[model samples]
Target: MTSPMEMDKLLHVAQSCAPPEAIQLIVQVTEDPHTHTFAKLAEAPTIQKLALTPEGAPYVQLLRLYTTGTWADYLSMAHQLPSLSAAQVAKLRQLTILSLAYQERSLSYATMCEHIGLAKDLRESVRILEELIIEALYQNLFTGRLDGVAERLDVHSVTPRDVPRTADTHNGHDAVFGLLQALRAWRDRSSDAITALDTYKRQVEQKYDARAQTMQEDHAALTDALRNVAQSDTGMVARMRLQETYPDAMDVEANRRTHSKRRSKRTRA
Candidate 1:
């Protein structure tokens, strides 16, 4: 039987390897009862060592797999770890929901690495927001019944009223509400626009141009909200000034561009 420490060392080595092999090794190590691989590693000395490594490249790849593997397995692992804060729990739940909806069965190893590489707190926040959007989508789209509409229309004939508004009714409204709530919770939530743009670019490259366009539009709307606070004053002059001053604020768009460049450089380095 392999000692726990030996299993840890081998797991580390496996994580350092590339591709399907790394994943395969992880599966094997996790299955080995002698390894104590099931134990929480959050406070382990090894975890600190791994985290201290530059950008946690190898460790993050492994952590991602641990967090997002088979749902039941991951959940069991999560329970073994240090108890999460309310915010952390919320975020993880959200991430799970979004992962199921949008990236289920198709999440790439690279994408998983990116998510796990994020600062722990930030990772939690992203997970929460993603899950929030997913729940909103589910609540708005799936749980509702169309029977009322059909009964009202009194015919099997296809019509606007008869057709349920899946995208527009649920996802659209929920997206707006959820985005606003998320922004309020984290004012410095980084650029939703930039995140959306990156996601869109990736999706487009993957031949999901239509989905990219929708994401782009959603990002644009959220970006506008980020810049403009709702005000009670509605005088024509106030409205004009709001419109006029908005352009100046928009003109400061240079700052966002510069920030983006800096972030890209930091990531590359």
Candidate 2:
């Protein structure tokens, strides 16, 4: 926070500095998020005037994003704009997005590209992705494997970036809009989890059903086998005490056939 008096003093000094000098003051002040001076200069057309110069053009663009740009629009400018301090801010905005897209320490390259609206050019996409990864690594944003072969950025750990609540735009409406976005994201994730759980449950049920059908068939076969054993009595009655004594050693089912054959032979003789 800064005093009204101090803000006026800074603004007056910015006004006195001519051309590129004024641009430097504006960039330096706005870069530090602590000062509320940006809102006042933002209200005036002075920063917009800075856009006339090449160097000032970058600063003006940065100020516009600070005061006027939507979150999505702000994030998408990283690759479109030339390398400047504003581009750094754009990268930070990108980091905020990636932080949300990550899952269990890994993010697929395709998903990242989709989330960021990566350029269609394969070469450009690779260049931007490498820059993003390097910046994240250098800034200690997270740590993990950026596997080219695997085609995914696998993070082992992460620290989330803070959402900006700048003097230019921090109000109830902003908060509510942010909340709505968060809820929508949560809803999407919940739906995916439910779908996956349902799939797994169906698979388990199918396996159980197949196994149950097999058991029923086995039971039916065993019951039929038992019925055949109980109903058959071709040679169950013992002819004599010798037949009973030798029952365990006799093949009664086989002997019945041969006995008829022997009787027929005796009759012929």
Q: Please give the CA lDDT of all the candidate structures.
A: 0.43, 0.59
Who wins the TM-score comparison? 2
Q: Pick by lDDT: which candidate is best?
A: 2
Span of 10 residues, lowest total lDDT, candidate 1: 152-161
lDDT per residue (tens digit) for residues 85-173 in model 1: 45434434434433333323233323333443333335464454434444534433112222222211111111010111222333235
Off by over 4 Å in 2: 1-132, 142-160, 164-179, 199-203, 206-210, 230-269
Query: In candidate 1, which residue pairs get closer than 3 Å at backbone N, Cα or C atoms, i.e. clash?
Result: 91-128, 94-131
lDDT, candidate 2, 102-124, per-residue tens? 43467766666665567534877
Supply every candidate's count of residue pairs whose N, Cα or C atoms clash at under 3 angstroms: 2, 0
Error of 2 at 108 (Å): 12
Tell me how far candidate 2 lies from the true structure as C-alpha RMSD in angstroms: 15.0
Question: Which pairs clash in model 2?
Answer: none
TM-score of 1: 0.20
At residue 40, candidate 2 shows an lDDT of 63
